[model samples]
Target: MSTGRDITALVRPPRSYFVNAPMGNNFGAAGDVATQSRILRAVLALAVEARDPGLILDDVLQWPAPFAFNPAPATPEAIAKQLRK
Candidate 1:
């Protein structure tokens, strides 16, 4: 689960963001990709719903993974830089 601070930041941010963590013990397990994809799709749907409802003031972020065994570190600034490419 994402920390309260992280979720707060997501909700406070002006732009949309997608946060991907790691699956639990099921990491690398069979059908993990399908499961993760489904999770992402659900999040996307929620984001769409929020937008349709004009709830842009709320958080439109996705936390696809509940656990991260060896996660990479990337700050929001770094991600923004990448998006400029």
Candidate 2:
């Protein structure tokens, strides 16, 4: 459910909404207010409803079309090594 492998989920803490997104734009696509608000509301609703701890809301926003991103190189190790520099 996590976008970038949230280590915190191992402990299962409060206010955790695991989504399929990048680091910054966790809720929805940047500049897309409607989607953002909707995501926020969903999380808020979970927060309000959740009584016990260890609540991880794993949800995926149904994007209209494919949300595109910069293509990654075929090999991750090569790109990761370059980024480390």
Candidate 3:
């Protein structure tokens, strides 16, 4: 399963699953077992049932909230500022 649909399309694996979640939380939220299990089962089923090559089955599950990622410190000055945070 993957969260990067563009990357997955470029890679073009024989069988893959796409989950609409944050990068780190591909299966589901950190502690939501039910959602994770459902996504896992769907991925597994896609692996078994997908017949065409480069087929990507999209997950129906949705992330509950907006995901915001902090920008990485790219420069020395930025790094120093981030350290202060």
Task: List model 3 lDDT by residue over 1-85, tens digit each.
Answer: 7888899999998898998888888989989999989988888888788889999888887678877666775999988999999
> All candidates' TM-scores?
0.30, 0.60, 0.77
Residue 21 alpha-carbon offset, candidate 1, angstroms: 4.2
The per-model lDDT (C-alpha) reads: 0.46, 0.71, 0.87
Alpha-carbon error at 70 in model 3, in Å? 6.0
Which should have the higher TM-score, number 1 or number 3? 3
Q: Which model, 1 or 2, shows the larger TM-score? A: 2
Q: For residues 1-85, what per-residue lDDT tens digits would candidate 1 score against the true structure?
A: 2223355455654333233433342123346686556545655665565543222332233445465456579989999999999
Question: After superposition, which runs of candidate 2 have C-alpha atoms over 4 Å from their true positions?
Answer: 62-85
TM-score of 1: 0.30
Model 1 has a clash total of: 0
Among all candidates shown, the one with the greatest lDDT: 3
Q: What's the candidate order when arranged by decreasing TM-score?
A: 3, 2, 1
Give model 3's TM-score versus the native structure: 0.77
Question: Which ranking of candidates, highest lDDT first?
Answer: 3, 2, 1
Tell me model 1's lDDT, rounded to 2 decimals: 0.46
Q: Stretches of candidate 1 above 4 Å error?
A: 1-11, 14-31, 51-85
